[model samples]
Target: MATPLIEICVEGIDGFLAAQEAGADRVELCASLVEGGLTPSLATVRAAVKAARIPVHVIVRPRGGDFLYSEAEFATMLEDIRILRGEGVAGVVIGCLTPDGLIDEARTKALVQAARPMAVTCHRAFDMTADAGEALEALVRAGVDRVLTSGQRDTALEGLAILKRIADQAAGRITVMGCGALDADSIRTVRDAAGLRELHFAALRTVPSGMAFRNPHVGMGGTGKDREYELTLTDTEAVRATIAAAKS
Candidate 1:
């Protein structure tokens, strides 16, 4: 079998360069990984594109929480796609679902049409759908290039059965890229077992802040965790290890 394409979900230019350096086949560039990846700024997108040797796919999510978007938010997504297309990105990852958990084909098709030659990937919002098979068909009809999913489960490993079924159901009409909680050790099993040719993971490791002065009074995120003094980055060795394992 051929080596699986490894896409590292990265936060900024730092993470993007790290993934590329570590031999990632591609990268999904975003702003707030803690917020599950929002649309990166045009500056960030330009820097990554200028520095990238591997393909860079920008995530066009306007906000976090649910995949449902208001009309205004949908408009924001379209404009972002237009800017990213001009920036020469390899693709865009987007998702817009109806209130009842079905693909918003109208909005999705519009985004796809806007994306043009650049590929369009339906993000994990596919997992939030009521039915995996039905959602896959909806994406195909919408002319999406691929989908990122975990079989509606929290992690790809846990969702192996449905992931495999989705791969089989795709039947060459669409590409099924398995993601969620995958890593170097488990990637091989997930790839071979789920019958996936592409895989996604963060490979993030927390590094303590470099600040000399420690302010122990206030935390930034308001979640009550002291992550203010820490940074999450894609570990180069971790990416290489995952690629090696998936290929071996």
Candidate 2:
């Protein structure tokens, strides 16, 4: 069997470059992993496209939360896609679903058409569909190059059975890339268990804030209104270890 490509989910330029240096085959560029990875700015996208030695696939998610998009939001997503396409990104990762949890075929196809000549991956929004098998067929019809999913489960491990069925059903029509809450062991487990050819994960670590003066009064994030200053960055060592472990 061929070694699977390790596509890292990177939030910033550092993570982008770190993943490449740490043996990532490609990167899914986005921002604010806290919000489940929103679209990065044009500057970030441009820098990544220029700096990355491996393929830079931009995530075209306008916002986080749900896969459903408003008309205006959808328009904004298209503009972003237009910009990224012009910037020479290797591909665009996007997905549009109707309120019923079904693939918004018309809209999705339009975006895929607009992103022509560049790979278009229908993102994990595929995991939210009414039916995985039915959704797979819709993605194939929409002409997406691949579908990133964890078998509609929180993690790939939890979805191995469904993932295997998806891979088997794909039948080479479109690539089924496994993603979601994957660590080194889970990465290899999903790949081997589901027979996936590509895998995605984020090698993130918490780095303590450098500010000596701590402000406890205000909170930057979290539900308790506590201003936690620790920042999460992609650990190159972690990436290297995960890659090595996956291969091992």
Candidate 3:
């Protein structure tokens, strides 16, 4: 079998370098992984582009939680793409949807047009669309080079069947990438069952906070069970393991 394209989702300079060193075909640079990824700072994008031999694709999300964007938020995303393109990134990841849970074709087309020369991967927001079939068609028409999805489910394993269908339907018109809760088993499943050549995952592992003193009463972000103290970063070991498993 041909080697699969492993795209590692990373948040900073360290993660980017780790992914390249570990043999990732590309790196999807984002921030706020807890919120399902937001746009990283321009500094991070610049550094990642300079430091990596593999391709670096920046996420164009203004915020997390929803794929729908306000006019201003959409504008910000376009500008971010422009800057990344100038910075010599391999591509940009983007998604835009309407209020009715369909691909916002016009807006998406504009974004893709503005992002000329830089490949665009419609992000997991494809899963949130009302109809996966319709959404896939719209993305194709909008000139998206790839679509990253969990097959319209929370994780790729659960949605392997739909993922397979998408790959067959796309027929190489656009790349279908299986992602979400990915690991060796899930990646192997996509290769065999879904027949996709691209895989995406974070490979995140947590380490204890650097803080010597703790204030149990105060939370820096989130709340209750959703607080941050540990640092969740991508591990190079996990990346190497994933590539080995995919090839196996």
Candidate 4:
């Protein structure tokens, strides 16, 4: 069987390059993976686009925490989108919701319009919506090209049922990209259950920090601690496994 295409999420320039080299179909570029993924800087966005052989989709989140955006944050998001579009990005990944956790159709539609000529992906904010079914319809109506969801659960494995439902409801009007905690072991089950064509994961592992010095003053437990950055590097083995499973 042929391998299914994989879209990997990258945190920085190195990760973007690695994903392309490791056979990713595309990359979602963002900054501060620890914060879940806030919008990347203009320089980083441009660099990723220039460095990547494949398409690069920049995340347009102003800040992390919630999908709800303040007036200033919303304005920032729009500005970021314009900047990235000008930089020749393939698409933009963003999501906005009302305070009540419902898709903000008006705001989302406006963003979609501003992102002309480039695809728009409604991010995991769909998982936070009050009604996944209603939100799916709203996103489709808003002209969103795709949605990144974990089935409204914390991870794809846990949310397979809901993810499958959303995929069925989407009915080809839009794509339902399964994401979150997707690895070689579970990729096959997710693909089988969701019946989705696209899947997302960070083929990255945490590496130990080389720094030996300990900041005792900053310790919550008053003891020296070890910390590591969540860096993105394509794990060829993991990617190969996921692709194989999808094809099966």
Candidate 5:
């Protein structure tokens, strides 16, 4: 048996380079981690693609509020995908939904069509849909290459059962990449339980806040936490452990 391949999500240029150095098979590039994740700027995407030794997949999210997109937002996403495709991204990650939490087939199909040469990944918005089973079929029908999900749970660990079922149901018709709260310690469990051979994680470790002083006067009463940025580097130890576990 072989170790599962890892896809690391990088929030910036540094993380992208780090992931490559740490031995990631691929990198998913995005911005605005605080709002979960938003599509990165063209400059950032281009820089990562140029710096990375591995494939770089750009996230095509226009905003962070919901998977449902307005006409304007959809247009923006389409344009972003076009620009990213031109910039030489290996793939594009995106998801769209209807107000009722079903796959917005029309919108998703359009995006997939626009992302022609580059592969398309349906992002975690799959967890937001009413039916994971139905959504999987919809995505397959729409011609998506893969899906990034946490098993429809808050984290992949909790979603392993469903992820396993999804993997079985998909039957290689589409790829399911388990993401969210994935680290070295739990990667093996997720892969074995989900019966998958590919895994995704940001491998993010918290960075020290540069702020030296606390602001006590602001209504939010707490230690003024220094901002934490997701390091672009992959955690070599975590990756090695995950690989070892997967092989075992």
Candidate 6:
């Protein structure tokens, strides 16, 4: 039963070519997903890594609330992870904390050793940790390769029992991704009760902005939710029916 990987949280390059033509398997790449995601313009990560074929995990997040950062926003997140590791892009979704929450581990192990060999996720800020099994063992001692939780509750099937106790305390040493508000009927119940191999979502919807002219008043994301003409992409058949309901 091994088929669950399906990551998909896009925002640019047309939601990363509509989540890689609706097959997704990876494609976080972000930028102002309504302030929940930021950082996304090394020319839209080199045009989604030259219109990638899969794997495109970008998201250095310079802003959008808090994960605590200051020294010049952690040196602009280490020069945006050395310019998205020289645009070879394949990973980088970081997190940093410590205004007394934990897991700052020297700026998260110096942004996971400057994101070498790419592959380094830790979004959802690990659900704003206060201690999810000590921030999943401080993101497996700061070498994090994955994590995009919802087990902090608010979705992911209301934190499917803390994502099955952080996937049984990450028995596989890290890679539990069961995101919030997952769709296609809740992604096979949070990937079979959180034994999840990996799965994040964003099969968005909300279209309506081929404006020909209409200014009823005003509202440019000043938190009034007028959403300039509205448009939240990523819905290639709802990412092909949530990857065919996580492979049936």
Q: Which candidate achieves the best TM-score against the true structure? A: 1
Q: Name the regions of candidate 5 deviating beyond 4 angstroms.
A: 211-240
Residue pairs in candidate 1 whose N, alpha carbon or C atoms collide under 3 angstroms: none
Candidate order by TM-score, highest to lowest? 1, 3, 2, 4, 5, 6
Q: For residue 145, what is the lDDT in candidate 3?
A: 96
Give the Cα error of residue 63 in candidate 4, in Å: 0.9
For candidate 5, what is the lDDT?
0.82
Local distance difference test scores for all models:
0.92, 0.89, 0.89, 0.84, 0.82, 0.86
lDDT of 1 by residue, 1-248 (tens): 77788889999999999999999999999998998999999999999999988899999999989998999999999999999999999999999999999999999999999999999999999999999899999999999989999878998889999999999999989999999898878888889888899999888999988888877776776664467778898899988888888889
* lDDT of candidate 3 over 85-141, digit per residue (tens): 899998999999999999999999999999999999999899999989899999999
Candidate 5: which pairs clash?
14-232, 15-232
Better of 1 and 4 by TM-score: 1
Residue 244's C-alpha lDDT in candidate 2? 84
Query: Which prediction has more favorable lDDT, 4 or 5?
Result: 4
TM-scores of the models, in the given order?
A: 0.97, 0.95, 0.96, 0.90, 0.89, 0.33
Off by more than 4 A, model 6: 1-32, 37-66, 69-121, 124-137, 141-146, 149-171, 176-196, 209-217, 222-226, 231-236, 245-248
Candidate 1 off by > 4 Å: none
lDDT by residue (1-248, candidate 2, tens digit) is: 68888899999888898888899999999899878789998899889888878999999998889988899999998898888889989999998999999999999999998898899998889999989999999999999999999999999988999999999999999999998788876788888889988888998998777788886677765554332666779989888988887777
In candidate 1, residue 117 scores what lDDT?
91
TM-score of 1: 0.97
Worst 10 residues of 3 by lDDT: 220-229
* lDDT, candidate 5, 139-212, per-residue tens: 99999999988989999999888899899999989999988788767887888788887788876666554555
Clashes of each: 0, 1, 0, 0, 2, 0
By lDDT, the better pick of 4 and 6 is 6
